[model samples]
Target: MSSSVGPGDGSANRDAEFTETLKSVAGMANLTQSRQVIREIGSSVIQCAHDRTVSIIVARQVLDGLAGKLRSSGSDDTAEADAVVDIADYLLREINAQGQSSNLVDQTVGLCEVAATAFETKEEYTEAAQRLASIPLDESRRRVSPEDKVRVWIRIVRDYLEVDDSTAAEPYLNKAKGAIFDVNDAELNLHFKLSQARINDAKREFLAASASYHDISFSPKLAEEERLHTLTMAVRCAVLAPAGPSRARALGRLYKDERSVMLANDFSILEKMFLNRLLQPKEIKEFAETLQPHQLATTADGSTVLERAVIEHNLLGVSLVYNNIPIASLANLLGLSNDEAKTEAVAARMIEQGRLVGRIDQLKGMVWFEGGEASGQNGSGKTAAPVDKELRYWGANVQSLAEEVERVTAELQKQFPGFVEANLVV
Candidate 1:
């Protein structure tokens, strides 16, 4: 008649058994045995445990078991990819469960990382980033410091950039920057700047992006590969830049750098061809044939950078030798077919972009270069008045300054809305 176990003791024994089962699952080496044990415990039992740490350990064990099976199989089966998706779903559920556990931030973040990596393996970059970004926005979180919160936000911005969706990336980038505003982490700063550069690039602001890349390329904190990649991007941006003093300076900086030689070998034949075109405009055609489709200027729609560079060089060459040239002849100099409308269209773009300091005469079918100032024909012909030229230049400067001020104001508002509004109120 000795012992009927008390209700409290019976509950305590079950809790201990559940905790021991978790430890056993974590330590299990035999994949088959681990799977069997998890099946025995069942989802209902595990969910009822309501212990975030136990959920994390079980999820990690399952992921490891799946990976071990794949490694041993030696052949990738479609079934394996499906298995990965299932595991990612499980991890996602675990993360949701842990949202209100203040002590489980690292485990929750780690589970999200695993899920993201799995999605990335399937080339679902946007989904991968979204999974991480969702953590910060979770309403159930017991506590998350802004600094800790930004860690996942940074990952979201990066993954969006991987898919070239800067429009979608913008909101997350803004969120990440706000969270890290008062934190002084060098790595986060670099990541933020890199995202900004990429966003500028996606927006087709090549000059500003080039400046950003150039600055990052010189950061002493960058790893070797990162520095090289940043420098390579800087060169690409410079080459794609519309013709101007800024483009000239960007090219000059690249040519003067010794690292440009390494870029020719490590990056692409495209780089070498581009460099040759810039330094010796005559070589544009010879190297132009080597450019692949991706080397094209993206904004120009299937037009290769080398082709545009050739047209630009021909324009510069003619400006030195002739006060004015027929549009057809200029097209011929650049090896363009004799299409009057097409040639004039190309010339018009260059002129409009200020790459060619000239005006296109459609009625005359000729382009005049700065009234022969470019050809030094002013010594042999007429010239615009120096006073008029100076005034026009200053007017352009005033317009440019106004545009830059407006851009800065918009950026400040985005980056520091509260401060901006407070200042405005004051």
Candidate 2:
């Protein structure tokens, strides 16, 4: 392989020169020559990777060049893809063969990061995150600064997020969260915020995610198109949030953001939410098409997240149009499968939980909308004193019923005393 002299290295010309040489050796068809390159890369080449930006760029290019070489060898089929991945694995194997805590410990840490970038380029996010996580950042082994820790943790978080592995990403997210306050880099801070928002969205903390995303959409660092895309994400998260007051505020904010009007498909639903208009099944189905698998994941009661959101939203809509509706009819409005009990249970739970801001009359089989907090279900998770309000209403109703019965009995005694006497103790 022909070598070029000092082609824009990440650090000193010597280190860059050495790395550029490894890139050439990586492309060689001979396996023996390729096998020997890992020692140089895992040691000298990697030890020089202090300039993270340039190091990542050059290292990623080296892996990309190898992948390109493998592809150029023959057919554009699955086997070629496998071969590309194999080359990356081969480098890791050779490095690990030398044992982990060699004199080149720093270089080993850097090499893992470099290898991870290659996996990420292939869209093998799980592997990429695993590669990055292999770095030992425990202060005992390596005393990494808070900023540095945040950098690596955020990278791992971003890769895990790509595969929707929020559970796995969580510990690292906490680690980053604790360390991020010390980080002053604008770009890194933005990345951390964005990652947190993604995790929230995946975990179905949609209202929090909506607020975070909307905040990000206003960042000056993003391009106009990117801002619009972020705004769209904010809308999606808000829509998925359980129907309640917090979600209402989120929706109201987005509705007022003139840019929301630019969202072609999402704008329709946003408009429905703003006006308390009922959403059609087809319209929700269309919006659901754009959701991630987790967004459609089923809840405890066997309904999907989208279905739950729609049911809650529709119930609020029904309350808006009717002062009181029968449980059976409410079930129809919510598109529940003739399960009046299920519908009643759902409505009652939302009301009692301080989500729906209304009440259900089980005996009369009716939903009575007080209509005070229409846009505000207080849903998703905001605490309010619901028990006191409900109990007060219940006490007032009991008193009112007694008064009406007494007044009716008085009229009966004055008009039909014999009939009243036959039925009453008095």
Could you say which candidate leads in TM-score?
A: 2
Q: Which segments of candidate 1 are over 4 A away from where they belong?
A: 1-10, 30-42, 49-85, 91-110, 121-124, 138-140, 163-167, 265-306, 371-426
Q: Please, what are the lDDT tens digits per residue for candidate 1 over residues 303-420?
A: 5664565455455556666777887887776666776656666655555454556665555667777742222222222234222233346768989999998899899999999989
Poorest 10 consecutive residues of model 1 by lDDT? 373-382
lDDT of 1 at 275: 43
Summarize candidate 2's per-residue lDDT along 151-171 as a digit string, tens digits.
Answer: 999999999999889999988
What CA RMSD would candidate 2 show? 12.6
Q: What TM-scores do the predictions have?
A: 0.65, 0.71
Task: State in Å the error of residue 416, model 1.
Answer: 69
